[model samples]
Target: MSAGKGLFVSFEGIDGSGKSTQARLLAEALRADGREVVLTREPGGSPGAEEIRALVLQGDPERWSAETELLLFTAARRDHLERTIQPALACGATVICDRFADSTRMYQGLSRGDLRRAVDTLHDLMIGVEPDLTILIDMDPAAALSRAKARATAEERFEDFGIGLQEKMRAGFLALAEEFATRFAVIDGNRAPEAVAEDVLAALKARA
Candidate 1:
């Protein structure tokens, strides 16, 4: 779909790199700066997407094959874009989303190598939008995994993949950032939340 006038920023990283927290902080910071900001997340940003989120995130890890899970994620993303993200941008609101399509690429592509082609193809065919800027919170997988497990939520399907998979996911994200250098900012996430937030803002300012 076509992009709207406002800025679209997405936060991505391994499961517990604190990307979500950073997204929230960035949104608050931007709003305080007098910008209209919309804070949202993927897999459940909008009403219809939230339903899909439950089916994907709350079930057993084996509930769907890699390809099947990719389709489900694409469907939820379609709804999320149409209902929440696109509309907010159309209205000139900066949209800060936690976990956009990159999560799908890293998780599905790295987990099931063959599905990487399918992920890219389906994304181009059905969801042809990319974030204006993507903030990758790069960090150590072991530390991130510890944080993820400590949260102990029902949506632990991805987190249950353990430290090894998290390591792979981290590498995938870094590779993605390299591939899309113009639209990505890789931030060191092994720091205090406030420090990370400051770095994030600095990165955005530099980009601007």
Candidate 2:
């Protein structure tokens, strides 16, 4: 905890699982309550990380090997932690991040290859911090993938992997929640965005 006792929260799930929307809503709700809130996203929070985000998120799915992608993501995360996250926490601001290291654990560690150990090791060594609370929006893979593809954004490299990857990611995320149960909250994301946001707030209150 910081001198001001800031709270760090992160949202994670399969692509298009509405975690981003929930993160945003949570930030808004906190702000409405007069709390200082800092909303950010992984792989692109800081300037250097944003540059790396383009390299990793855009282009072909195979633009980089899984091992390479892991390195790149770790690098971006380090810069994000130093420049964006740490500063906000130091200032006693609630930091609500869209995605974080757990996404890297799924995408490059499990889904892409058997790099779970490597991911953990790198995380412990380079980025030895985890969110005080991690809210995972659980949902059906097909539905989430459909919503993801509907956006048709350039960040579709991972989405382009199709439903198979989405299914794998969903299961992996669920397992991850269990693996880190103490800091993890699983919320059903199959409902409307407002409903999901309500549950997110409830989860935060429970954690508090």
Candidate 3:
């Protein structure tokens, strides 16, 4: 870890678990505190990564196999790190990412199959960057799905995995968080947005 490096914080959850909102609030709060902040999301940050993110979330992913999807995510992460995250961190700008390596591990590694192998492969293949902190906005899978459906946005292939599978994905994320307790903050996402934002701010304050 670079002691002089910018703080690397990741916000993770199912599609409608309020992660993005919390990340935004936290970024704004960090800025208000006179800290430089870079707020970005995974699967996309730079132009090229945005294209890849679109491919992963909005396209006919049936064109690609599960193995292919995992590899592509890792590729996107590598570019994101090399081109965006690394430089910002080197300059000491705290980076608050909407999602990061853990998302892939939950969506693909645990939900899909071969969890252990996927973790190993991604670590070996990517630049091996992990977040300094990961906040998991925890909520019931059914509630999260309902919120997601209300948004009426284009669904990612992962979101279409059905409620049953999504429940498993939730469990997967929780288990993964458990494995890295020191780096995780599991907050109740079912709460009001302002309350949730406060929770996120508290976590950031603790870390900061």
Which candidate leads in lDDT?
Answer: 2
**After TM-score superposition, what is the CA distance of residue 43 in candidate 3 from its true location, in Å?**
0.8
The TM-scores, one per candidate, come to: 0.97, 0.98, 0.93
Looking at model 1, report the run of 10 residues with the lowest lDDT sum: 109-118
Error at 21, model 3, angstroms: 0.8
RMSD of each: 1.3, 1.3, 1.7
Report the CA-based lDDT of candidate 1 relative to the real structure.
0.90
Candidate 2 whole-model C-alpha lDDT, 0 to 1: 0.93
* Top-scoring candidate (TM-score): 2
lDDT of 2 by residue, 96-124 (tens): 99999999999999999999999999999
Question: What clash count goes with each model?
Answer: 0, 0, 0
For model 1, the stretches where C-alpha displacement exceeds 4 angstroms are none
Better of 1 and 2 by lDDT: 2
RMSD to native, candidate 2: 1.3
Instruction: Encode model 3's per-residue lDDT on 12-122: one tens digit a residue.
Output: 998788898899988988899899999999889877788788878875636566677788778888888888899999999999999988888877777776765766676
In terms of TM-score, which candidate is stronger, 2 or 3?
2
**In model 1, how large is the Cα lDDT of residue 204?**
83
